[model samples]
Target chain A: MWRGFSMRVVSAFLIGLLFGLGLVVSQMINPAKVIGFLDIAGDWDPTLLVVMAAALATTFLGYRLVLKRGKPVLDASFRLPTNTVIDRPLLIGAGLFGVGWAMAGLCPGPAISAAAVGGPAPWIFVAAMACGMQGQRLIRP
Target chain B: MVEFTPLSGAVGGFVIGLAAVLFMAVNGRVAGISGILAGVLTPVRGDWAWRAAFMAGLFAAPLAFWLATSEKPQVVFDHPLWLVALGGVLVGFGARLGGGCTSGHGVCGMARLSRRSIAATATFMATAMISVFVLHHLAGF
Candidate 1:
């Protein structure tokens, strides 16, 4: 009863809420800001650097301490990724994502969060991202 | 070069990190946006509810912010619909193929000191930087 569906759902909701708020507060939803940072060849914003550094620092510190504990508060074990082999798929996939990210400055999280304000671009990006994911399902080996 | 708010950016990033930490601590999840949304696309048993809750929370964030601050979250997509759509496809597919994205590999994986995530993260940044350089400089996009 303690570690049930309700708790998981509620916690996820709250986490999503915080994530969305953080994205918004950080001005990360702004395409210009993202593109500016990515445009390393030209004038850069360096805003993402700060956000990324702070986020990385916090996550690294927290993970170090929390990982030393028993399993998750609710789950049986920590669900960490296992694959360590860096291969072509990983490089190409990340490259493709980066191209898309620079081209439109819309990644999964930002795209979803920006949909709250954007007229149609967010919707279009999300729909296409979802389709791309589906396409991967059909093509993955 | 346009908008640079380091204080807010750092604070927001820390909040995002906290969310990521809590997610792993309580739910034992990685908090990767691509994987999370991808799961919703191909719903597995015992996974949809929390995903739905998280997504709902994301959708609600902007509205909640507006209510609190009387300011809409700034959203700017300068790319045309077609380009944006294409970018989304690439990002979606690449995330699926790469096994992760910025949040998953860049933050979560790196926090755990996973070498693959490190390599993947480096590759994506290189490609993203190159992509932006080509689009802005060479291609005149």
Candidate 2:
């Protein structure tokens, strides 16, 4: 059991590292850059849309590739979401997230991705994100 | 110079999704940043190693980018700290309520085309627009 947990940790770390690396390579780690596109006050930064499109395409193709093989890279099977339909939680969460993104121009991936870049604001953003998660745990149900 | 093709974004996204899927297969966990960070607050003795390593990779990737480009990308945040804090809390709340952050659902889950993630990502995107509209347009803050 312990070994299994350890393996999982290793897997999670690699995934996260790749995720972070992607952010850097895509230049999403820089909020000024992100906001610059969103700014619309000057020359818009259309670069993010390009990055997002590329990411979407890759994931789309990846799913097609992986679905063919049942098992995953590690010990477990692919844990795809069982639900196929959209619901209220989905709507609410997206609305909230979009609001946050528009306000900050730094979504969770980049917020945490760019944490080490160091601005009191990003750290504060991360702190609230954690606290929000903790607050959820505190809520019953 | 190498052609400045937009394909790099797609390639980067593909890599991130593929990396995450691989990591999940091996690790048996969702690549949720909120959960990972939450794990750190009340951590188990041995658990710390992987979490720390994971976080280290997140921060270190930029250095790798710098090494490759020989240019440290400029990082900036134009928003005030208070708004940043507000936005962060909302993301945290949304993640907790929905049970995953953008990396977990938007990047990883959406890659697999999971409905939950799709829904979550959609909501996340929408809320971002609304938030921005409110801040820049309505609230005028």
Candidate 3:
């Protein structure tokens, strides 16, 4: 059990590191870049689509490779989401996320990763994300 | 005007996604931004180190990368502090209400072939599209 917990922690750290690196390399850390993409009148940037395509390809390939092994390298099997039905929470959350992203052009991943840049936006985003989480906890029934 | 490269963004996303899968497979945890952010919010005894370390890596990796590559990254944001702050708060709230974010749903959850993640990701993408449309097309803000 101890070993398992430690393994999770290590993996999480590594993942977070790569994520931050990706944000830097892709320049997704820049809200202007993202906002520029959303800015249709001012050249209509589509860099974000490239990021999504790249991410999807990587995830798909990784899933295929891992699933082929029939067993994960970790302590337990992969925990796929069991819920399939769509509902109001999903819709509202997505809408809100879009609105926030449209306004800020910084989603959670890039926002958190950009924290390394030590800018005003990332810090603000992290704080808000936390409050949102805590607020949910309070409202959870 | 900054040049946008589709290939670079895609490659970056792929690498990040691969890293996320490795983290999940080895650690048995979903790469959900909410859980990660939440973990740090109300940390328990002996549980703080890993989370702290993980966050540290986020900042350190980008710095290390810039040093190694001899490249400087730029940040662009035209909004005032108050707008950015509000955006952050909204993201946090949205993630909690939705139960996941891009990392968890798009990369980790989707890799596991999770329905919830798929639905959540779809909603996220669609909402982002709509938000961008409104921001640039109708409102022109």
Candidate 4:
């Protein structure tokens, strides 16, 4: 039991490390780079497009191979998202996220990763994000 | 205009995908940053441990890179503190309500060819582009 728990924790840490490294290396942690990509009406940067395409392609092939296994190594079943309905919450929420993303040029992954830099902005953003999340729970729950 | 770095982008993206695949293989979990983070905020029994470990790793990546390379990753925020805070709130709330963010919906869910993810991605991407246009061009911010 201990072995299984440790394995999951270690694997998760390593994977998160790799993901954060990718964000840093790709310059996705830079708000300027993200804004440059989103500002198509201005001096648009196509780098993010390449990044997205490459990520999608790699994940496309990688997930296919991974899912072929009957079960994960440490877990009994894949905990994949099962909700299929493209409902109101999905659209509204995505829309809100998009606007916020453009306003700040940061997403969840990069935002959290950026916290390592130890600045007021990232921390403030993260703290506000936490509050917003908690607020949502308060409202919904 | 932002400097284009296709090679680094692709490499980083591939690494990100690999991490996602590895996470799924070991823990059978999607590497969704928002969901993982939300789980951390609201701890559940027998969970949250791996999530905390993963977040810790994410927080460590930039420090690790800086230690190894003596260079901190660039992070710039053009928006004001209030705007950034508002954006953070929106991102946090929207990601939860939407059930995923860029990493979950854009990367993992799209890779799996999920229709809901596709729609969510489309909505977010389009709105983000529009928001950028408005902010950078129309509003001249």
Give the winner by TM-score.
Answer: 4
Q: Residue-wise lDDT of candidate 1 within A9-67, one digit each (tens)?
A: 99999998888888888888777788888888788888888988888899999998888
The parts of candidate 3 lying over 4 Å away from their true place are A1-4, A40-42, B44-49, B136-140
Report the error of model 4 at residue A59, Å.
0.9
Candidate 1, residues B1-141, lDDT tens digits: the string is 466789999998898898899999988999898899888888998888888888777778887898999998888776678888998899899999998888888888888888888888888888888988998899887
Q: Can you give the TM-score per candidate against the true fold?
A: 0.96, 0.81, 0.87, 0.97
Model 3 lDDT per residue over B75-106, tens place: 67666666677777777777778878777776
For DockQ, the strongest prediction is 4
For model 1, how big is the iRMS in angstroms?
1.1
lDDT of 2 by residue, B19-88 (tens): 6655555554456666566667558776676666566667666666678789774457767887788777
Count of clashes in candidate 4? 0
Better of 3 and 4 by TM-score: 4
What ranges in model 1 sit over 4 Å off?
A1-3
Better of 1 and 2 by lDDT: 1
List clashing residue pairs in candidate 3: A129-B92
Individual DockQ of the candidates? Answer: 0.81, 0.46, 0.58, 0.82
> Which order, best to worst by lDDT?
4, 1, 3, 2
Query: For each model in turn, which proportion of the native inter-chain contacts is also found?
Result: 0.81, 0.55, 0.61, 0.79
Q: Where is model 4 more than 4 Å wrong at Cα?
A: none
Better by DockQ, candidate 2 or 1: 1
Q: What is the CA-based DockQ of model 4?
A: 0.82
Give a tens-digit lDDT track for model 2, residues A1-141.
Answer: 687667656666666678778887766776666655454444556666677666666666766666577676555576555656676665675667666666666766677767766557778888887776677667734
